[model samples]
Target: MNQSLNRIAAMTARYYYILRSSWLRLLEIVYWPAMQMMVWGFLYTYLYQSRSAMADTAGLLLGAVLLWDVLFRGQLGFTFTFLEEIWSRNLANLMMSPLKPAELAASLMLMSLIRLLIGTIPVTLLTLLLFGFNIYALGPGLLVFFLNLVLTGWAIGLVVAGLVIRQGLGAESLAYSIMIVLLPLCCVYYPVEALPLWLHPVAWSLTPTYVFEGMRAMLIHGVFRTDLMIACLALNAVYLGIGFTTFVLLLQSARHKGGLLTMGE
Candidate 1:
């Protein structure tokens, strides 16, 4: 067990070192979030000009875009970090060691957080300068939403990572497609009521739905829903449990079938 832990530490340090050495990696992380903020900032400004009634939603959509990126970065961070092992054809080596799946999952979560912080902080800062909107104004609520978003990302990422292990790179699209499917239902830029009445149940059942709804309530109505925050935390717990369990099972299946040894090829 101690040897496995040591190996995990070495693997983490190697990846961290790679990140530190790669200036392009840093720039790539900064690029997309900044790009999104620019596009959305212009859109928000245009809406404020074109529709007097839309003026009240100045930072609402922009804020959602920023917050949603947290979740996006988190999931991608976790999955891509895991896939790095495969792309380097090192996953089989790790699996051949005493390293356990749970340990690997936990490490991936930590690395995801590191990448998320690195990716989003600059974009958040830039959004403030570009739009004069400070997401930090959400105060402690900002932290709440951030945690839930990352956890939700990890949940999705775990499932993606597991599937890739089971079915190879062909299943890789699940990483982005699954999140895209949830985008409309997440109530990111609009309230859940904007969806059809029939889809309301499905939307509300998602953790991010409460997150965006609560964000809107706070920003627009100055009303913070403790209920929504509580709901997100509760649902995240359940979803994360399911995601982790599925990952472990899928990984075991892959190992038994010897797919891990040949995944990157």
Candidate 2:
């Protein structure tokens, strides 16, 4: 027990140090959020100008986008940090350390939380303050919603990392492809009802759909519907489990294929 506790402490402290590195500059933290905010802000203004009645609807959509940015950015932080280490060949040092793979993974996930806090949290807070949306109105439901978002994002990161492990940089094209597919389906700037019925199941299966819905529920209605919150929590757990399992399998495959040690020579 003592050994496990000490290891976690060390990993967490290392994560803190890594987060403070120049690579994680304030600009890097804010860049994605700013881009998302600008694009969505323009769209909202345009929609409001076209139809003044859509202002509240636009607010709901904009809030979802803001929250999604934080979740996506947090997961990306973990995956990219690990990938950069691998590209620079520094991962070899980590692999040879007394630390375990799970510990290293934990550290990366912890870094995700830190990045999310530094990057995503600010944007979320700003959206609430500017749009007069109260995320905390649902209190515990808000917490559950955020947790679901984090887990789902982590799962996506794991799957992306697995592909990177198998195909190296060549697999990176999938990132854009994923974004293209997800943006319309994730209910980022619109409600799921706006999507055709045939696509609703597909969208809801993506986890982010439920997350956005739950967020909208909490923010717009200020009431936690037991069913929605429970569903979101379940989806998060399922995806998080899949992500961790896939990450482990890919890590093993990489080890067997010598991918773990094959850095830029």
Highest TM-score model number = 1
TM-score of 1: 0.95
lDDT by residue (51-170, candidate 2, tens digit) is 577766776767677667756775677677567665666766776777666666677787778777788666666655654444455577667767777777677777777777766767
Give the RMSD in angstroms, all C-alphas superposed, for model 2.
2.9
Provide the lowest-lDDT 10-residue window in model 1: 3-12
Query: How well does candidate 2 score on lDDT at residue 258?
Result: 80
Candidate 2 CA-lDDT value: 0.71
lDDT of 1: 0.88
Quick one: best lDDT, which candidate?
1
Model 1, position 248, has a per-residue lDDT of 91
**Candidate 1 structure quality by residue, lDDT tens digits, 54-104:** 887878988899999998999998998998888888888888877788788
Local distance difference test scores for all models: 0.88, 0.71
Question: Which portions of model 1 show Cα errors greater than 4 Å?
Answer: 1-8, 49-51
